[model samples]
Target: MRYLPLEEITEDMCLARPIFNGDGRVLLSNGVKLSKNYVSRLKEMGYQNLYVYRVGEEISDFSTPISDQTMREAIHGVKDAFGKAAQRQQLNIRDVNEIVSYILDEILTNPNVLYNLMDIKNHDNYYYHHSVNVCIISTLIAKEMGLAREKVKDLTTGALLHDLGMVCVDPRILSQPRKLTEDEMATVREHTNYGFQLLRSERNLSILVAHTAYQHHERMDGSGYPKGLVGEDIHLFGRIVAVADSYETMTSGRVYRKAMWSHEAIRQLRESAPEKYDPDVVAAMERSIAFYPVGSVVVLNTHEEAVVVDVNAKKITIQFSSGPRVNALMDLEPDSEIKIEERLS
Candidate 1:
């Protein structure tokens, strides 16, 4: 299966994976044959791309660390909690902690899961979806860095609540299709302080979690907002969440811009490491994310196109252009010349 732009879709193309609604209900199920009508409907609903099966393309299960049920639950939980935060009302701290704990449990259970951010997003639920995605990516990065169990939990909790301040921002500013004005940009940047104040009010919560919301926007070069903290001054949780936030924001499409490819986002992170972002954190994230995720169609150096079926320790399993499958390291030793040339959209 391969990701195709909506305009590229034709009749009789089958969906490789199910698309879910904001409520996590199946909008369209896998293996469903598509028609022009179906494509038009999805386009009307704001879907720009889809995963469809190509002839002779091998289907692979794209596993995530958490289940869809858990994802929906977390999204709902964030929506409720963040709404309360925006109002300056006391949050159900216990409930929020429990939800974070549950997510941590799932990540810990699937310690080696190669994270793929494939959650369906809509305009109304972007903030909720983004928070959950950032939390997952941050936790996986912490795991990759070999952080202690307790530290991992703290980082995960902090990551989940990092964007709490966005709730206070005006929807009009966020939804603006054009670039924000200087004044509007300043107001948008105040979310960090807003979120920090809200989270810091909960005495039962860790101060680090509040700091996560506060310092996530800070840059290592003292160019970040609010405090403009320099390297080593930024808390570990803050740095981790910052990297996750950057990645999720880049990959998750917004009204103002198209979503970037995974490899491109990773490359941006790598290039900015130790300057705009923490080098160690960027490295951890790079190791955690799949460069060429499952179902992605890639052209090899040999001029053959294939779909990545699975990624393993030292190599990836791919269904070659010839229709046969092979488990070979696409970038090393014997298969050194067979590098991935480009990832198809």
Candidate 2:
């Protein structure tokens, strides 16, 4: 199975895996043969890419740190939680805790797996999807940093609800496809304080969680919003969530722009490290996500094309060429000249 841009999809291909809506409903089933009409409709609906297999090609098993069952439940839980928060109603802290526990367990079990943020998004529920993706990425980074399990859980909770203030913003403004005026930008920026207030008001929640929502937008150089705090003045949880939130948002498609490739996003984070984001946190994030994720096609230094089947130790497992004679390259010699030259979606 390979990921292809919408323009590359043809009637000769088939869906290698199912696509789901934000509510967990399957929009397209696995193994469905593609047609010109289906491709056009998907494009009309804002789909950027798809996982496809050429006719007669084998479908590989897709795996992630979390299970499908847990993902569905978490999505439903986040949707409900967001709705109540938007209405200023009392939130069920116990329910939220249970959801966080499930996610933490999954991350702990697959400590080595790179978190994939590609499949969890859809146009209908951007907020909920973004929330879950942030939580997943943040938890992975926390674990990579060797934080205590308690700290991991705390970070997970903070990441899950980091964008709570967006609920108070006008949906029209939040989804606006054009640049915002200064007044409109100010209104949007208030989400940090709005979220901090809501989280702080809950007696059952920790003050640290409130700070997470507060400082996730802060920068290391005092250029961030709300408080514009500088350096270590920001809480560690906040710093961690800031990296996760930024990486997730950069790699995700938004109303104003297309999603970035993982390598490009990582490069941006590295470039801003120590000045904007904490250098350590940026390094942890890079270690926690695959630069060449599974199913990505690439051109190699050997002038051959390959598909990435797995990733380990900053290197990828590849199957070269597109012919039926498949050979897996598990590891490169220390002096091997072969390297990934480019990523082709």
Q: What is the lDDT of candidate 1?
A: 0.79
Which residue runs does candidate 1 get wrong by more than 4 Å?
Answer: 54-58, 117-119, 312-314, 321-337
Candidate 2 Cα errors over 4 Å, as ranges: 312-315, 322-337
Cα lDDT tens digits, model 1, 1-345, are 666777898775888877766544567988888888998988777677787885444475656777877887787778888878877788887877888888888887784577754455667667887888899999988888888768787678778888888888898998786679999999999999988988888988888888888999999999998999999899988889999999988887655678888899999999998899999999999888878776667887777777776653345556674433343323322355567889875
**Which has the greatest TM-score?**
2
Which residue pairs collide in model 2, if any?
A: none
Q: After superposition, how far is residue 309 of candidate 2 from its true place, in Å?
A: 1.8
RMSD of each: 3.0, 2.2
Give lDDT per model, in order.
0.79, 0.81
TM-score of each: 0.89, 0.92
lDDT of 2 by residue, 218-271 (tens): 999999989999999999889999998998888877546878888999999999
lDDT of 1 at 190: 96
* Model 2 per-residue lDDT at 245: 90
- Candidate 2: what lDDT? 0.81
- Residue 319 miss distance in model 1 (angstroms): 2.0
